[model samples]
Each structure stands twice: as C-alpha cells, then as structure tokens.
Target: MNIASDIKPDRRERALAALAEKPDGVVEAIAGKAEVTPAEILEILPQGAAVIAGKDRFIDIWSEMTAWGTVLFIVHTDDIVLEAEGSLPAGSEGHGWFNIHGDSPIGGHIRKDNCASVTFVDRAFHGRRSCSVWFMNDKGSAMFKVFVRRDENRELIGDQLQKFEALRDRYAAS
Candidate 1:
C-alpha cells in the first residue's frame, strides 16, 4: 500500500496511524469462516500476510513514527507467488502453472499430484499461532511458505510440512 506522498501525507495514511496507536489497533481479526472488506482488513491483518498477500509495508525503524501511514506498500520481490484460491490442480481454472515443460530450466515437477491436497493448501485456517499455510504444487518440486510470525515461521514450518503430507486424507484426491 502506498502511503507516501510527494509533498505531504495522505488521508488514509493518517487514519491508519491513529488506528495503530494503542494495543496495536486492537480487535482486527476474525474467526470461524467469514468474508471481509478490503478497507478494514488493512488494519487487522498480521504483518506477514499483509506483505505476502500484498498489503502495506513497515520496513524501517522510524517507519511508523514518520510515515505512520498504511494504505498499501508496493514491493518488488524477486518472484511473485500467486495463490490458487478455492481451486484444484490440473483441474484449476486460469494461471498458477509451474514451468515444468521440457525446455524449461526450472525443472522438477511438483509432486504429491493429489488434487485434494492442493485444494486444502489453498484454504486458510485458524492456526493456533496464526494462519499458518504452506503450499506445494501438485508436482512438489518447490513450495510457497507463509507464517504469522517471522521468527516462528521456521518453528511451525515442520508442522505445516507434516500437515501437507496429512492433508491428503482431509479431502478426496480430485
């Protein structure tokens, strides 16, 4: 989210700063299954999900003090991982394909070829710590990583790994 103004600050940025003042802008999350609007989600979302899910950025020490605004920070990552929301593999709709062809240098197909597991990975959950989710494509060559906490990201990485293996049972392989 872009809160930076060439000359001065923006309105949304000012509002976000005020929102973050106490207890980290308390009460900004939901449980069970629910749909949310993009506007309010900006405040409640955890940092990692915000960034990875393309939310605002807080990249500096005096970041919030000065800029203190949050709209959406545009980041240039080496590679962008697109989510396959509510879809299955091979059977999915558009895009989300890996470069697994013969001429492609990024060889090694995504394994586990279980369509059911693929769908589950795309689904987010109310992880104890946070919404922990790891998604490996059908071929399993590479995987996408996400966690609620940066330090703990590695901690539950194993759990998610195991969950990946176990999720095959949760859904019938498509």
Candidate 2:
C-alpha cells in the first residue's frame, strides 16, 4: 500500500513541484508519528489562517524504519511576509525574492518576535541573502519548513496575499 510509488517520485520533490506551479508560495511539510491522521494535522493551524492544504507522503529521512508518514501544505508566501516587522519590500517592479521569517539560532529570538531576512541582490552580485522558513530547534537546523516566496507585480501580488489572508480569517484552524 505504498502511495508514494503511485506518484513515481519522492514526496519532497513532489511537494516542491506543486509549489512551483504557483508564482509566489509558502510550502510546508510535517513529520511526526505515523498514527497521526491527516485531520489531526490540519487542526494545528492558528485560529485564523486559511491554509490551502494537501497530502503527500515523505520518507522519514532520520528514522531507521521507513514506515512513518508526513504531511505537506503550500500557502501563498506573502501572507506570512505581511507579518514582517518592517515595511513590505517593494520587490523590484518585476522581480522576486526569498523573504525568510523565523527565529535565527542567534539572539534573533530576543531582538524580534518574527525575525525576517530578505534576500536582495546588493552592489555585489555575490552578496545575496538566502531566503527560507524552516521548523528548527535550539541549535537551529530545520526539521520541517514553511516554504516562502514573493513576487513584485504589486497588483497581482496584493491580490494573492489578500486571497490567502481572507482564507486564513475564514478557515484558520488551531
């Protein structure tokens, strides 16, 4: 009963590909006990966030037994970005960037409630910021993630973000 076989690809790859279809997105995956049903997983959202959800199986990269399961979701990345502390980045009129939001292992936790680092190309092309949002630990390495991206079309960008935010207010689970 291996559903992963029917997909004919790895779940992480499959999940990433799903997010790729949307220009700006927030992809997510969670790995816990196998007996945990999908319904239970969906119940963990904040009391008000419309999280467009999905299901795909992931091999436990760390487990000795390959029998455990994982769940994935891809929300519009901007919803989380709007939670940023500073002004919304005016993405290059027609460019994109990885806006990372999470706690950095350093004193980042104490400095900001939501520590965000935007990846903007600086004077030097090599000096670029890495964008990511991962579920990590005390030492700060990701165990899981909420994939994020942003687009600069202002109109379309605002629409997509509003759509996601509206969904959150309507169907946010916790």
lDDT of 1 by residue, 85-138 (tens): 111112111243322333222233333222111112222233333332233233
Candidate 1 — what's its lDDT? 0.27
> How many clashing pairs per prediction, in order?
8, 4
Off by over 4 Å in 1: 1-9, 23-49, 52-129, 132-158, 161-174
Predicted candidate 2: what Cα RMSD to the true structure?
Answer: 19.0
Query: What lDDT does the true structure give each of the candidates?
Result: 0.27, 0.24
lDDT tens digits, residue span 1-174, model 2: 112223324543434344334313222222122222222222222232213221111111111111111112122232342222221211111123223232322111112212221111001112322122232222212223321224443222334334334433332231
For model 2, what is the alpha-carbon lDDT of residue 101? Answer: 30
Clashing pairs in 1: 1-72, 1-73, 2-72, 110-138, 110-139, 110-140, 111-139, 111-140
Q: What is the TM-score of each predicted model, taking all chains together?
A: 0.21, 0.22
